[model samples]
Target: MLLTAVAPAVWGTTYYVTTEYLPPDRPLLAGVLRALPAGLLLVALTRRRPHGVWWWRSLLLGTLNIGAFFALLFIAAYRLPGGVAATVGAVQPLLVAGLSAGLLGDRLTARTVLTGLTGVLGVGLLVVQPGARLDGLGIAAAAGSAVVMATGVVLSKRWPAPAPLLAVTGWQLVAGGTVLLPVALLVEGPPPSSLSAGNVLGYAYLTLIGAAVAYTLWFRGIRELPPTNVTFLTLLSPTVATIVGWLALGQDLGPLQVVGGVLILGSLVFAQLRRRPSPAPVRAAGGPAAVQDLNA
Candidate 1:
């Protein structure tokens, strides 16, 4: 779990990197460069291709987890205040908890629901500033991002990969990058004719560290940890982002923000304390085989 926590924590740096180093108003291009090269690198290293249903499954998962999620998130960032979009996206843990109950047969307790709500409230306090304007389209996009990402998390657990972890992650990245390539070209036009050393470095950080390493760790966490648990870790992203801003960008670190950060941390610990049920026994052919709950 500590290792899994690293993924979102590193993701927090993206905001700082984008604002300070990346070119202005070119989110799609950033997404493409971030996803595609890292994906191809992984594929090259693993030297594995999708087999059977994975070709289509990879595309669907890629769309949900990466392509669509990134697009919608970028739209929200453009249209809504970052605070509002993040607060709205906080509903992801709740969505994941409910989905786990329905699809994964995990028990949904009052504590879990309350904890999820606490996370949302904490994020709202931490980020939502006074008089932050709202755009309906941005709210929709943020909500959609939450839904799609939650579904992707559940579906990833529902469908275990036959291939190795890097291979599976590579496939999703490639598929997502492929989907993003055209949208980026059509909407954003070609990449910038020239990039500075800083721009190059920022893109490289996003690709190698942000997507490649972080996602590998994230997918490993999904395979090893509870889905609800994994989803809750996302709250850390904003928390870390806020801290980075305060420390690095000289943003204000008010009392309320401190309180909000505390709440987020407390909620994360509380959620992790939930008691997981034991895996059920399964009989295969002649012998008994245990059907392990991967989420457990």
Candidate 2:
């Protein structure tokens, strides 16, 4: 889960990067640049293709995790204030926890439920601005993005990847990029006729760091960690973004942001508290092998 945190933390830079260097009115194009090229690079490098059910599974997961989610997220980001957009996404933990409990049969302890709520509250405090107005479309897109991403993560955990992490990530990336390709062309038109050096650099950073490296680690973590626990790590994105702002953009944190940080950290610890491992079954000398199996 610690390694998985790197992905969201890397993603924390997206808003800043998009605003700073990427071309305006090109959200779908940005998604293409961020997902397609990097995915193709990964596929080319691995040359390990998915066989069997993975072909369709990759498409579904990619649509949820990358194609639809990125499109909706970009819409929300452009339509709403940054803080409001981020706050909207902060709903993911609760969604993940609920989906894990209902669909995956993963236990939802009270601590986890409360901590998930705390994460939402904490993120709201840290990011929501005073006068953030809610756009209907932005809200819908933001909420839909959360639901799609949470569902994707839970499904990814439920269905273990048959291939190695790189191959799995690459497959999904390609599937997702392919899904987004038509949308990008339809909405944003053909790729920009001209590319500035800054645009090239921004695209490269997003392709290499944001998509390839971050997603590889992300899928690996999802393959190993419990779905709900893994989703909790995403709460760190806004925190990382805030820290980046403070360090790079000279933005300062307020009192609420400080308190919000504490609550977010505290809830992260709070959720995992009292998670004792279940002990192995002990076999009695008189017990039959079948009886031992039941206990196991």
Candidate 3:
């Protein structure tokens, strides 16, 4: 769980890095750099590759988790403030809870529903500002990104990969990057001709820590933790982002933000109280609480 939690915690840095360090007007390029290089590097390192049904599955998961999610995430980030954007994305747990009940047949326990609602409420306190102007396209992208990823989380649990974990992870990264290559070029044009040292360093951090390292842990946890439990961990991302912004960028931490952060943390801890780790061997099927892997 600690390992999987690292994925979103690392993701929390996205808002700051995108705004402060990355080259301007190139979110698609950033997404490509974040996914493809790490993926190809993993592909190069791993001797194993996808087989039979995995090609399409990897593509679909990759598109949902990284390609479309990343593209839309950037759009929302570009359109909305990070606080507003992260608050919007915080709905993933609720979406995941519903999807899990439908797809994974996990019971919608009272604990799950209550905590999910409280968690979103906490996030609203932490991030959403009053009278925040909304953009039509941005709202659609943010909500779409959440839905795509929420669906991907459920589907990944439903279909456990046949390939080795890292290999399966690499395949999705490669597939996601491949799909985004043309879209980035056509929609946003090529990678910027000039990149600052901070930009390069930020990209490197995202590619390695955020994508490769973080995603491996995410899938590993999915193979171990319950679906809603894993989704709940996403709440940490915004909290972490908010804290980081407060410290690094000197963003103000209003009283409400503090209360909200505590509430979110409490909700996350409460959700995990019932998570008993599974000792069974990995298998193709996801029984209720079946260990599955990978997420946005």
Say which candidate scores most in lDDT.
1
lDDT scores of the candidates, listed in order: 0.93, 0.86, 0.87
Ranking by lDDT: 1, 3, 2
What CA RMSD would candidate 1 show?
Answer: 7.5
| Candidate 3 displacement at residue 11 in angstroms | 0.6
Superposed model 1: Cα runs more than 4 Å off = 276-296
Off by over 4 Å in 2: 272-274, 277-296
lDDT of 2 by residue, 174-288 (tens): 8888888898898788888898988888888988999999999888888887877778888888988988888888897999999988988887767645667999866666659
lDDT score, candidate 3, position 25: 82
Sequence-dependent TM-score of model 3: 0.90
Clash counts per candidate, in order, are: 0, 0, 3
Clash number for candidate 3: 3
User: Candidate 3: RMSD over Cα atoms?
Assistant: 9.6
Error of 1 at 83 (Å): 0.5
Q: Which candidate would rank higher by lDDT, 1 or 2?
A: 1
Evaluate candidate 2 by giving its C-alpha RMSD to the native, one decimal: 4.9
